[model samples]
Target: MSQVTDQLAQFVVFILDQERFALPVEQARGIERWRTPTRIPGTAAAIMGIINQRGVLLTAVDMRVILGMKPITPTRRSRFLLVHEQIDCAIAVDQVLDMLQLDLSLAEPTPHRGTVASRGLLPTPFGFATWLDLAALLGSINNG
Candidate 1:
């Protein structure tokens, strides 16, 4: 007899710097094609700026820059991953490859994964999490 099993994970997998990473789906809004963002003043280097997604202002954050990697200059291929965490709204990524349903049973804390050691962020058994402070991210927006 063959066995079938179901897997569960609370995150959405994304691509950045040609690497596979994940973020909590609870906070994810959706993904969009590349669009020029209106840069904000006096914000962290990682903060790309504001973008209008269907009339909603989304703060487009460059994941590479947030991860301490060199930022990619905006390109036609660039995309945005809209997410909201503890605030009205915010953006968390520059590009997305695909949405993956991670299996928590096969998942391990990022810190425990030597292959992903270079990635500063860590994933809980359920999914990957950002060390970026929510207050700090929200504060960047005049109103989030």
Candidate 2:
């Protein structure tokens, strides 16, 4: 489970394939309007390719591919959820719902068999959000 504290933690809540997901605010750099990324040859399926966000190059990872969900076409509603880490990257999401402050103490521990991105499952008024372990997720994609 995510670390439970007395105070609330803010998360960037986004939707993918009609399901809710959360990324810790600290790990989320910023959200940008979906820019068409330049494709690279012989890259992994999940890697949409590299994008230059204000001159800084970043790998564009398809969240749907990473999470094993159906792929979606880029639309006006699409956005890039930038992730701050050792090497910055961006995740393509269907929609960004809102930012939420939730009590992780209410989070439920999931089995290790859960998806690679899951840090835990948090219940929001909207629905359950699978909190992301972004470092693990990005590293796994890089290392895999």
Candidate 3:
């Protein structure tokens, strides 16, 4: 069998503005509705604040701000994806789209000029989704 056909991975797709983005499903702990996170005084600009999930504290990052897009008021569809990489954190998104199973080989390296947090881009039937590089994203947050 073809290598592409033999390798599959799942992704959690979400929306930011009108664009779609995704992260590997294994990296996400869970998805929850928007909650007001307590503001931290010295956090990065992209860090929205921190929210307590169950007993754990999760730093919330605003994806729109990180992507250089204007922020929009949260709607009923707004959600937070709890992701774990070098750190455990959450990112706000306009909406949680869907879970997709795709061939691993379909991921194309993101162009050098592309978003810093994007490791690659995946083309779907609906459109293209940027594949988030959680480690890079967390590093950017830390360095900022």
Candidate 4:
């Protein structure tokens, strides 16, 4: 197996609604306070439109809608997690909880019947946190 498939990986955990979710730490560029994005016409509903980040245009995606949760207004704890896979985009989250180093062996494969964008489910003291497939998620956005 390759080095990536052999070792533990760090994940940035965050809340969507009542459930917890995470993204690979390596893909996360930065986190910033919620900023309203400029709405673009003819884009997916999950796409909150684009925001200018230090001169570069970054597409902001609403995780709630993508995860099939009811959309809520951005609160004080809301944050934008800047992630880069094949593309650089901002993921709008309810709140950033914590970062954890997870052993890949501990993760359970996500149910095949569920969302295709979920990579696996990491068990925590609170409950199972979905590990998001950033590449698949971005691909869905790009394809739409």
Winner by lDDT = 2
Compared with the true structure, what per-residue lDDT tens digits does model 3 show for residues 25-131?
87888898898889988777888888989989988888787677777468999999988897788989899888887666778887642345577888766678888
* Tens digits of per-residue lDDT for model 4, 30-116: 898898999998888889988889999999998787666787479999999999898788999999888777777889887642344
Candidate 1 vs candidate 4, TM-score winner: 4
Spell out the clash pairs found in candidate 2.
Answer: none
* Model 4, CA-based lDDT: 0.81
The weakest ten consecutive residues by lDDT in model 1 span 111-120
**Candidate 4 wrongly placed segments (more than 4 Å):** 1-6, 112-115, 142-144
Candidates ranked by lDDT: 2, 4, 3, 1
Q: All candidates' lDDT scores?
A: 0.57, 0.83, 0.79, 0.81
lDDT, candidate 1, at 107: 46
* Candidate 3 clashes between residue pairs 3 or more apart in a chain or in different chains: none
lDDT of 3 at 42: 74
lDDT of 3 at 62: 86
Model 1 segments beyond 4 Å from truth?
1-7, 88-94, 112-144
Q: Which stretches in model 2 have alpha-carbon errors above 4 Å? A: 1-5, 112-117
TM-score for predicted model 2 compared with the true structure: 0.88
> What's the count of clashing pairs in each model shown?
1, 0, 0, 0
